[model samples]
Target: MAHFPMNHPARPIYRVLSGLIGLYILMFGVWGVVLTAGESLFARESNWALGLRTNLAFSIASVIFGAFLIIGASRRTNLGHYMNLTAGIVFLVTSILMMSLLQTEANFLNFSMSTVIVSMIFGLVLLGTGLYDKVGPPELAEAERRSRDKQISEANTP
Candidate 1:
């Protein structure tokens, strides 16, 4: 990862934004899992044991998914960005699947909302930065090409 000083061009804002988004994803994930596992409104059933098991499974899954997103976001490589995008898609898919099969649609909705909001913010950042890293900045590319063209022109002039 390129280290940028506080005064390094536009680096400060971008890094801070990325870090905040990372924190959001991690925090939301941790909270959602905890809510599911706790003796809360949604983790209710005639059979307390069953309810505990169901909520515990959900809690574990949510935490795992959230952790994956956080790790992916922390990586600065193009592969890392793609991994984060995949994690976002996983959140979307899990939300839809849970809603379709589970009776607790409301909790699922909350899960969907938080995952999507955090995932999108982080995913958008990943995509924007990945593109910038891959194709080089437009002005820089143009200048490099011009320099190369000038060299070629001089080489053939003789």
Candidate 2:
């Protein structure tokens, strides 16, 4: 089974970084909403916010998603771990899909290349944070550490 660090020493740092990303997204969404208020839901007109194109539909979605991430990052339990993992995967998948439809009429989100790039970056960071943010009881963490040490020793012996 794959090992995800539990009770990592740097978990606080990771959480802070994730929260910062969430804040940025939230601000971007708010700005997008203000800028795109008079436009159609999925308007193709040029509306940029925080260096990314936007529309009412996309801005609203960003608001919700950003808030979700913020909540996840603020949690102290395993909920944050699972939430970050889910959000990471969603960002990655959605970015890829949007990138594919960039030139077509199907790009309802009005995702520019910059937006896809930022999403991919945020996805990777969130995924990494999730991998290291798992928390468990002391005994479980010790057992996991021992298991990791054993695996490392075995690999070194070979």
Best by TM-score: 2
Q: List the global CA lDDT of all models.
A: 0.47, 0.93
Write down the worst ten-residue block by lDDT for model 2.
Answer: 1-10
Backbone clashes for every candidate come to 0, 0
TM-score, each model? 0.43, 0.95
What is candidate 1's lDDT per residue for 1-158, written digit by digit as tens?
44211122443344445455555544544554555555553453321221222344454554565555456546544444455445545545654564454445455333333334444555566444333332235576567667768978999997
Candidate 1, residue 88: the lDDT equals 44
lDDT of 2 by residue, 1-158 (tens): 77788999999999998899899999999999999998899998899999999999999998998999999999989999998999899999999999999999999999999999999999999999999999999899999899899989999995
**Candidate 2 lDDT score at position 86:** 92
Show pairs that collide, candidate 1. Answer: none
User: What lDDT does model 1 reach?
Assistant: 0.47
RMSD score of candidate 1 (Å): 9.7
